[model samples]
Target: MTSINVKQSGDQPNSTHCRWQWRDEELVLLAEKAIWRPVSQELFVADLHLGKAEVFQACGIPLPSDDDRATLLRLETLCERWRPKRVVILGDLIHGRLGLTDRLRADLRNLHRRLHAEVMLIGGNHDRGVQLGTLPQHPACRVGGLWLSHEPEQPIDGRDGLNLCGHIHPTTTLRQGPDRLRLPCFAFDNVEQRMLMPAFGELTGGHDCRHRYRKWLVAEGTIVPWFDSAHSSRASEVGR
Candidate 1:
């Protein structure tokens, strides 16, 4: 288990929202912690570190054991709400071999059956340590002229389609008064034509998205635009 220092995120109640547009495709960024592609009717999520709590508990870190269940339920909820035809898990579906348990496997199979959506996984670093069955070991996947990956690596020169990835577990810091809140975010690097997704697991920590790109912070049940630079603070907020 990676001994990462976890931060408790603030709770905000809001409807599932935060939509964006790219390449003539409408992206519905659900507060449920998934991206809904309207054109393909697919949901894209990343970095679900299932069974991470068990790993931490084994390492003497006091963490709740329900982390895996919570993560799975959240995904199920999104599926029920959006009714996507398919769900594309970017990477790191499970934490590692030790984290992969029979119970977890059962839950995954059950969820797959319940959602009845074609689930595609593009393996990530953690997934490399285990045999996740049928899912490809390829570093990237192509779907509808878009590149889906676990890491945000630039494509070969002039490669067509934009790259969407998750690994860093990006987040944005919002300041109000003397306090600052670190919230999960979607980091879009317009310059690189790549987007970084937030960690979808409840027990997962986050990487502060300090890169110089636009970000959408999940707040008050909606997605708000967070400008890393004072220059872009004048932009409008984006959400449902």
Candidate 2:
């Protein structure tokens, strides 16, 4: 596990004061990702494309060979540490219309059996044809304070409070010295009360976000404010 340090900046005292810790709580932010314990140790991940590489290969797009296996391994490593009771996939569990191949299905089934945790899926754009209903579904399922869903909706008054969603694979640009880096990030909207997660899929693409909401750049295994002027300039240049 990576050790995270909390630093205080004069400009943003409140935000900086927020320590990134993994505990049983309503809200915990880690490396630009928010962890919510709505139902015990249930961990939520968004946009994990199990068979993305195979789908791309079917389309004649030659991608790196080990993308799917690598992503599954990454998830396994995360789950092994967290030891969650369940894993709720927010959306886009599969990539493309090809759906879950036999190999991918077997991988998911094996993961669920090995972890001994229930796996739930909320349908997303790419999951239209996928038979997620064939998998287990839980009643009163949730992540954070909001009910998990594929699409983002306006918050209903006095209900659930906020929605935890992932569809727009958000990315932010940061400038360090003369060079600039565009990194995948998680975006939180305080006014709208929605949390957009960074895509967890190894074969997925990201949408660079500027002029949308406040951004936090995820680099060096920590979440930092992407508010520096140079960062803005780098974002502008990349936008152009």
Candidate 3:
């Protein structure tokens, strides 16, 4: 089993972040559902799905207008605080072609201009080969020794790596017989050497994680190590 060291970050005294030693690298799991590489000074977030609320509104399904704004604000806050050398977004940067609005575009452009770091995006299925406004899109890229992409690596196709990916928008459920709740989580597949990021977007749906991937729940502005309900003993054993 791969060794992992987890600790609550004192620097983030509010408990908004945790420092994790995964493999040979140090990764910070932020309450924003993003990853921070202290050594590289790089910030990684996934599945922003910006403009999703706007797209829903277009379909006559009413959703609050602030989703886009709230998401952008989070991104801006992360960038400003971390001041990373670059910001890497895993995938699904925007909800759909329909999500694009003049205001959204302008806000994105303004955010781009204001950020001092380089921005990189990997287009996802929702992207449909369409770039995020004027942002550059690449099929995949390597950063900080990890295969960074929107989708998970397929070993059968001969593609594999210590990958950092985001498309699944992983979540775990808690049920108390009549009550049930779902929470977003980051999942790690040790054998595959993949770290699956949770959706960074507010208006997003999620898939239950595969049992093989141990999970870290992003809850209540804290990153919590969570063992599987069915196999709590095994999950805890592996996580430790």
Q: Which residue runs does candidate 2 get wrong by more than 4 Å? A: 1-25, 32-39, 132-144, 155-160, 176-178, 225-240
Extract clashing residue pairs from model 1.
Answer: 14-221
Task: Quote the lDDT for 240 in model 1.
Answer: 8
Q: Judge candidate 3 at residue 131 and give its lDDT.
A: 52
Model 3 lDDT at residue 180:
47
Alpha-carbon TM-score of each model against the true structure: 0.84, 0.77, 0.83
lDDT of 3 by residue, 1-240 (tens): 332333232443446777877667788988889999999899999999988988899999988988877888778888889899988889898888888888877776666666678888887888776655668677877664578889997433344446889999998665443454577988888887889999998799999774677778787787877553455444434444
Scored by lDDT, the top model is 3
Q: Per-residue CA lDDT of candidate 2, range 1-240, in tens? A: 333332224465334213332223364444524353644777778888768877777889987657878777777777776677887788787886574777777776677876567778877877776664346433323544565665676554446456677888888654444565667776766667677778887777788777556666566556665444444565577658
Full candidate order by TM-score, most accurate first: 1, 3, 2
Better of 1 and 3 by lDDT: 3
Looking at candidate 3, the ten consecutive residues that score lowest on lDDT are 1-10
Q: lDDT per model, in order?
A: 0.75, 0.65, 0.78
Residue-pair clashes per prediction, in order, are 1, 0, 0
